[model samples]
Target: MSSQLLSEDFAENIVTTARTATGDSLRSVTYFTRSDFDQLYLRDDLEQDADLNTFVGHEWRGYRETQNAYQESELGQCKFTVRSFENGYLLRVAEDRRGVLITTDGLSMQSYEEIAEALKRMLQDADDEEA
Candidate 1:
C-alpha cells in the first residue's frame, strides 16, 4: 500500500508519498516531489495578456472538477489546481496509477526544465530503491 501527503504555500505546493515495497520489507520507502505555481503580470513579448484569459478559463473548468472530487472524497487539501498569471500558464499535478503526473500548459522553457528536474529526481529515487 502507498500513502500520499499534499501541501502548499503561497509560492509552491508539494506532494510526497511512501510506496510499499513489492516483496517484503518492514519499512516502506518514501519519496518527495513538488511544484511551484507563481503569478506574474502579462508581458508584451510573450503575448501574456491574450493567453492569460484562455489559460484562466481552462483552469477554472479544471478546478471545478478537481474540487468536486476533493469534496466528495474529503481530500480537498491533497489536490491542487494553480494558475500562473506571470507566465500565462495553468499547472496541475495529480496522482495516477503509474505514479504522479504533472502537466503544464503555456509554461516557459525554464519552468519546464525545473519540472523535468523534479520528476527526474523522483524517478531516480524509485530506481535506486529497487536496486
Candidate 2:
C-alpha cells in the first residue's frame, strides 16, 4: 500500500511504538526508498510522505528498495538488525510485512513480546487503511 493511504492513527502508532520501546531517543521514521530519500523526507513528516512525490519523473521508491536489497545480499534473511545509536539501538525488521521498530538500548526483555504484538497490529492497521 502507498503511504498516502495510511491513516493518522496508523502514523501515530509508529511514533507511539517508538516511544513504548524505550521512552526516548527515537527519531522519525523516514520512509526512504530508492532515490534521494533524506532530502525528500527532511521537511516532510511521516503522515504526509508518499510514493507519488517524485524527484524528476520518478517518485522516491521508499523502503521497498532497502528491504529488497537486504533480501538479495549474502547476509541472507534478517529477522532483525540492531545497531547502536547515541541514545539507543535502531531495530530494523524486514519481514514479509515490513517496517522499522526503534528502541533504546536498554529496552527490557519483557517489552519484546508486547512490541511485536503492537507492530503486528500496526501493520494490519496500515494495510486496512490502504484498502
Candidate 3:
C-alpha cells in the first residue's frame, strides 16, 4: 500500500536516499506512522512474507511506546535508535508520530549517522511544514 502520511515524492526520495547510501547491503526500507506503514523498497533477494509485517508492527508499536520512557532521560530527546541483528541492522529515525525504519546488512557507523541525520532533517522539515 502507498503512504497516507508521506507524499509520493517524499517517499520516493527516502527510498532513493537509502538505496544510494546503503548500496548492495540495503535490505528493506519502510515508512511508518503510528497506525499504518508502507514498504517503500525490499531487495529482490529478500522474500516477501509475514515477517515484514511483523517487523513493521513491532517497530511501529515500539516507537509509539518507547519514546515516552526517554522523554525525561539524562540523554535528552531521542533522535534515532539502532538495533543490530545477526545479519543486519535496523535504524529508526522519527519525528513525532511518523518515522522511517531502515534495514541494512551491516553498514559502518558513518553511513548510519549520515542517513539518520538526513532522515531526521527531512522529518523535522515535514513536521514544521505541517504545523
Instruction: State TM-scores per candidate.
Output: 0.27, 0.46, 0.88
- In candidate 2, where is summed lDDT lowest over 10 consecutive residues? 36-45
Estimate the TM-score for candidate 2.
Answer: 0.46
Model 2, residue 44: displacement in angstroms? 16
**lDDT tens digits, residues 1-131, model 3?**
35666789999889888888899988988888877788888888888784666777788777767788888889987777889989789999876778899999998889999999988888888888888
lDDT per residue, candidate 2, 10-73, as tens digits?
A: 5556666756664543444433223322211111323444343352112122334555678677
Error of 2 at 105 (Å): 4.2
Candidate number with the higher TM-score (1 or 3): 3
Please identify model 1 stretches exceeding 4 Å from their true place.
Answer: 1-40, 43-45, 74-79, 82-131
Could you tell which candidate, 1 or 3, scores higher by lDDT?
3
Model 2 alpha-carbon drift over 4 Å, by segment: 1-5, 25-28, 31-79, 85-87, 95-98, 101-105, 128-131
Task: Return the lDDT, model 1, position 127.
Answer: 51
Report the C-alpha displacement of residue 11, candidate 2, in angstroms.
1.0
lDDT value for model 3: 0.84
- At residue 96, what lDDT does model 2 achieve? 42
